[model samples]
Target: MPNSLSARTWVIAATGLAPLTWGSTYAVTTEFLPPDRPLFTGLVRALPAGLVLLGIARTLPRGQWWWRSAVLGLLNIGAFFPLLFFAAYRLPGGVAAVLNAGAPLFAAVFALVLLAERVSARTLLAGFAGVLGVALVVLRGDAHLDLLGVLAGAAGTASMSAGTVMTKRWGRPPCTSVLTMSGWQLTAGGVFLLPVALLVEGAPPALDGRAITGYLYLALVNTALAYWLWLRGIGRLPATSVSFLGLLSPLSATLIGWVALGQALTPLQIAGMVVAFGSTIVGQAVAGRRSPVRSVPVAARGGTGVTNEPVNGR
Candidate 1:
């Protein structure tokens, strides 16, 4: 369905909420969750949340949806979630967020190759500015650079980027509700992580009150519910616009750090925020002017492949 004015407003508001919830993750991790068991925490976050959503949706995907959902789940949630937690464990919150900021650039690249979408020079330059802004915000006096952490963050970003492009390319089946579609991916991702969690983390660790609460919040609010809203927006909005909204995740984290965690922001961090926010605006404006690329008809390509289109805007 084309987005109505109210739908557009709702999606924009919902998009804002997803990132704000994401931002609290850093503070929650440090203050509440067990520090050494990042993978375990990720597993908990994905699995339980997935189960809950699946239960609510109570709809199994039909036909090839099973396979498609599984693939999307791995990229969007399974691999991305664990890798993101690993990055958080190894790096500072700001640093991890900064690295993740590269996701849009990665998305653009994947769109070009996988979806046959074209990238404008302006979008490419904006991508660089976004990365630079993230660098300015997170990299401090050379103290925060860790090669391993950076690599992990990059991997996580790539996973999510690939997922985003795939989502846009494939869209969703007509019979599926947004909730079911999201539930399928989350459940698939959770299932994928379960064995890994068992082998790696083994059993659950002793949890303090804070850790328990944090896990619940991450599972319920951040993973399950936030994902529903995000996917809903993604389905309705343009891909580029959806990707740009991701900037709010880091920006929200920065604010949460300052207000909730009392983490001090440097002057450079402030500057970085301005640039990052600016890049988002610039990207959106440029994207708005261009018409979406028409994908090869699904019939022309075997039903197995996806046709790429421009990201949806409300």
Candidate 2:
């Protein structure tokens, strides 16, 4: 039991790293990447990372995973990137982030329906509090709402939430390592994005040194490694606990903007960050106290836990 708890804690902390890396994306995109080419940018992030992981894993999806990988890829990456970018374009300030902060709620609902996992009141409240905190940190008083942007943001949030729950629902095949599974999804997502990017944005933008560096960083670190960790977590942790970790992205963005980009944070923003961080911590704690919520029965899972657990943390 102690070992199980330790293993679970380590998985949570490692998975938490994904969102932290993702938080830096706004800073990298604004400062380094070319502007107004979201689809192309997303393509760069997904395709290269996917291919690299696939090369390393040297495994291909078999049987149902081919279609399952495609569906997961579209939900988690291909569709998500475009919709999120669309919301970012249409929505002002941090409105998109605020909407996305509700992901825990979506994940909770989906977990209940799809996985038959029970939602605790504390987790639900934490989800709402996280939203309020994100709004405080990102949403500017002058920010105006666009109806289309709201829809896009909501859709993106739902897509990812559903994807997360589904990933938890369908544990990886016994023969496939998490790395290979991640590669499959990334590759499929990138393939899906290719024509869309070409059609919507025309030719890819010319890249300077900084742009190239940015793309490499995003592809290698942010999307590839980060998502590998995220999907691994979905395999190990409760869907809701993993979703709450996403709240860190906005908080991370706020901090990066403040430290790296010299963006100002108001008192309220600081407080909001505190609240959001608190909610994430509390959600994890609550989840820890509960019994492991199995998306699959023990016999089908080929026994308990991922064999390769990262060094323990948080």
Candidate 3:
């Protein structure tokens, strides 16, 4: 068996996969999913995936978690999804992802205010590099980056940033696993979105076999599995550090664009990828090693341990 530290490394790596997989959202939405149905798509992705996870876990939220689930579900899933899909549809693939890369900056500020965590100078540098790198990788003179898309992306980032910090602060119920927490939020978000989707979209669009396959991929792999791992990591890692992993989404999207869509990466984009990747590593490395759970172990180098670390304190 692996030692504690080594095991934590694997967990962190696993956490990284969630966003990396999410990076393909733009291409997936444009090519595979029904267009102009952001709300419907969002509903399907969140509701069913959540139900599946809930069915497997068979765990329910108790007491205050009912509202907590609502709040988290709205921010992390409901609002974020519509805004994200709106941006994805309006902007070029790179543009939306580039806007999302702003999440770490927002997360850092939220951590400082809400959790009292300090943003280090190195991390600031990392943020700067990350932004610059994303700009280089995605911003193109010819791409029509819409104002509405930019706003939607910014809103999505802010929504998710707040949700992420809040999740880290509150932690999950003592008996709850990440899957249960994710299920609660997903279910709540889906519920919130259902009426909105029905009201705005008229009805869920018809789907053929290809669309069904796409929705299944999104529900099972992208939303359900992704959120479970992400929530798990949030409870175990510094919220700000976890936010930094989001930069990988754009990079992953870029690669998918290149391979699947036959989009070409310029030399500048390749250089930017290096800087973005490097900055993400440095930010996480300098952000310290542990998350702050309330009742976790002292030596449980694994992120699963509960901690008393200040929301803003080391």
Candidate 4:
């Protein structure tokens, strides 16, 4: 039991690297990457990473998985990435972050309906707390909300929420590693974005040293490694619990802005951070209690196995 608990804790922390790293994306995109080329940016973030992972894994989707991978990719990355970038471009950073913080609520609903997972009151409360906390930390009263950006944010959140539940439902192909699965999704998403980016944004922007460094960081560490960890977490933890970890993205972004960009952190923002982080803790604890700890098999731990569905049977 102790081992099981420890293993779960480790997985949770490792999985968290996804959102935590993602927090830096706003800074990177604004500072280093080309300006106003969201689709192209999304393309760079996903495609190269996908190709690299596919090469390393030496695996392709087989049978129904060919289409399944495409669908999941469209929802999670293809749609989510473009929309996320679009929203970021159209909206204030704080507004965009607050909109994204609503993802846990979307995940909770999707889990109940699609995955047949029961929603607990505590989890629901925690979800609300997460939203409020993020609002406090990042949202500014003077921030203007663009209608299109708001819609994009909502759509992106819903798209990824559905994807998260579906990923939990479909699990991965038998005997496939998380690396291969991530490759399939990332490649599909990149492919989907290709024509759209070209048509909407014209040719790619000129790359400088800073741009290259930013893309490399985003592709290798942010997208590839982070997504591998996230999908693995979805396979191990409850969908809603995994979604709750997304709160860290906004928190990470706000802190980065304050520390790296020299933006001021008001006392209210600090309190909001406490609230958001506290809610994440409560949500995870509630989820863990609901999901009784059991020993994870050796195969699941190795990242090469079937039956890598959520441990709570979500």
Candidate 5:
């Protein structure tokens, strides 16, 4: 119990930074990156960041890991980035963010189906509460939600959620650290995006100082550093619990708007923030409650040989 609590504490802190950094992406892209270049932006954010990590780690996928890495890369970074980029571009950033608030619910459902994880009703309620809270925080009566953007956001959430669950199930290779594993996924995702970015968006942006600064931050801190902690947290923590932390993305973005952009927050939005935070706390408690590990039968655990003399039942 003590060990689990200690681990959760650090995982929460590290994972929290990922969403906070991600919160800045919408603002940064609109302010500093080239306009209407979602594909190129996504590509730059993923591929270069990935290559840098690979250079640092100096590792390659081993045997079957090549395909495993590709699968994960496609789902988590390659496809996810493009889908998310489109959503952010087509809709208001807040609208895009509110749509993505469904990620934890998707994670919970996927874990339940694929991993045989038992999800509590409290977690489900928390997910619904999160959606409501995010709606309050991000949605406006005048906001026009785009259907394509909504679909893209839903698909992105689903992709990342499944990737998170699968990462937990597979863990990493023996003798490989989390950093190197991140390199494998990042590099694979970047490679996949290279041709697409060139075909769809042509040449890179004419990056001036502001654009350069923004790209550097995204590549280094948001992609490389953030994903390292996120993937590691998935490995150590419950998939649903980690997914719940994603709620902070919209919250941080809203807070940034309030402080940085001078966007006004009504009393309702403030109350919603409180509810959203409470939901995160409740969901984590429920998801983080440890279930006992199912022990392997003695025969499987290398007890005295019984296979040759298995006459009792058969």
Candidate 6:
């Protein structure tokens, strides 16, 4: 077994990778997938990938877990995915990303409402800063805004934020693994999309080799693998801390836009990135400071009886 320090380090690294992989979605969708049918693309990206993960896990959720999983899936994946794709297809990538940055702010509100979690001044400030950054990025030099796209993105972010808070509120059942929890959500989301995909998209498009590859990467790696890691991190870390880390998603998307897609960033966009990322870091730091410290029990370190440093100061 890895030591506590090593394990924590791995979790952070894995967390970072998840968002970075997510950042690639814009370029992948634009470059590879057939265009114009946003809902269809969302269906393909979610349902197939979800089924594969469910097969691998081979653990069906039981009792209350089923309902909980379904709710979470709808909010986090089913609704969020389709709306996100709609916004992405309709709006500029920078604008979409900026709108999605409202996730943290939504999360804060939902956390207070659902989980009764207190929001500190620091977190609130950070949330505002993040929103400002997003506005800066989206507004940029353009005078006109895509109202439909903005609404879609904001709705998607709200759905995801509610889901995140619900997950934290519900916590995980002792009998279920994070993989199983994730599988349930994916399966539910996929099932929800099946009819829509069939009706709206009709038959699957004739995919070229590159498109096929992109779909595979998105389904297997981005949805299944990344989601699994994310759930695990949520189990281990503070809810606010984990939510704050999501600010990186937009930042990563910005960088990926610049590097992979050869999209040029205006000065406003750069400023937005700094403010958004900086606020996230500050929020997490403040949240961490307020949380109580718990000593690491030696037995958790594989029974060596040598206590390791507390993970996340708890």
Per-residue lDDT over 1-314 for candidate 1, one digit per residue giving the tens place of the 0 to 100 score: 34434445565577667776987877888889886777787788787887887788788888888999999999998899888877876886467877888877888888778766567888888878888887787676644767898898899999998888787667776556677878899889988988888788888788888889999999999888888888876655556666777887777778788888888988888999899889887776676555343343443323433333333322
The TM-scores, one per candidate, come to 0.86, 0.94, 0.89, 0.94, 0.89, 0.85
**Candidate 1 local Cα displacement, residue 251, angstroms:** 1.4
lDDT of 1 at 296: 36
Task: Give the CA lDDT, 0 to 100, for residue 116 in model 6.
Answer: 59
Kindly list the per-residue Cα lDDT of model 5 for residues 1-314, writing each as its tens digit.
57646656766788778888888886788788878887777777787888888888888887888898999999888888888878877787367777788888999999888666778889899999998898888887877779999899889989999898887666666667778878888888888888888898888868799998988988889888989988877765678888889998888887887888787989989988888888888877786565311222224322322211101110
The predicted structure with the larger lDDT, 5 or 6, is 5
Q: Give the least accurate 10-residue stretch of model 3, judged by summed lDDT.
A: 302-311
Whole-model Cα lDDT per candidate?
A: 0.76, 0.88, 0.82, 0.87, 0.78, 0.73
Instruction: State, as a TM-score between 0 and 1, how close model 3 is to the true structure.
Output: 0.89
Best by lDDT: 2
Give me the runs in candidate 3 sitting further than 4 Å from their true place: 1-4, 90-93, 143-148, 289-314
In candidate 6, what are the lDDT values of residues 1-314, reduced to their tens digit? Answer: 23644565565567667777887876787888777766766776777777777787788877787898899999989899888877876775357776777777788788677655677888888988987876666554554458898899899989988887787666665555677778888889888887877887788788899888888888888788888877776655556666777777777777887988887888888998889878877876675554432334434423222221224332
Who is ahead in TM-score, 2 or 5? 2
> Clashing residue pairs, candidate 1?
237-312, 238-311, 238-312, 238-313, 239-311, 239-312
lDDT of 3 by residue, 141-172 (tens): 87686899989989998999999999876777
Q: What is the per-residue lDDT of model 4 for residues 17-133, given as tens digits with 9 covering 90 to 100? A: 899999999899899998888888889989999999999999988888899999999999999988887787788847777888888899999998876778899999999999999
What pairs collide in candidate 2? Answer: none
Model 6 spans > 4 angstroms off: 1-10, 292-314
Against the true structure, candidate 4 reaches a TM-score of 0.94
Better-scoring candidate (lDDT), 4 or 5:
4
Model 4: CA > 4 A from native: 293-305, 308-310
lDDT of 2 at 30: 94
Backbone Cα, N, C clashes tallied per candidate = 6, 0, 6, 0, 0, 0
Could you give candidate 2's per-residue lDDT for residues 201-258 as a string of tens digits? 9998899999999999999999999999999888778888899999999888889999
Give, for candidate 1, the lowest lDDT window spanning 10 residues: 305-314
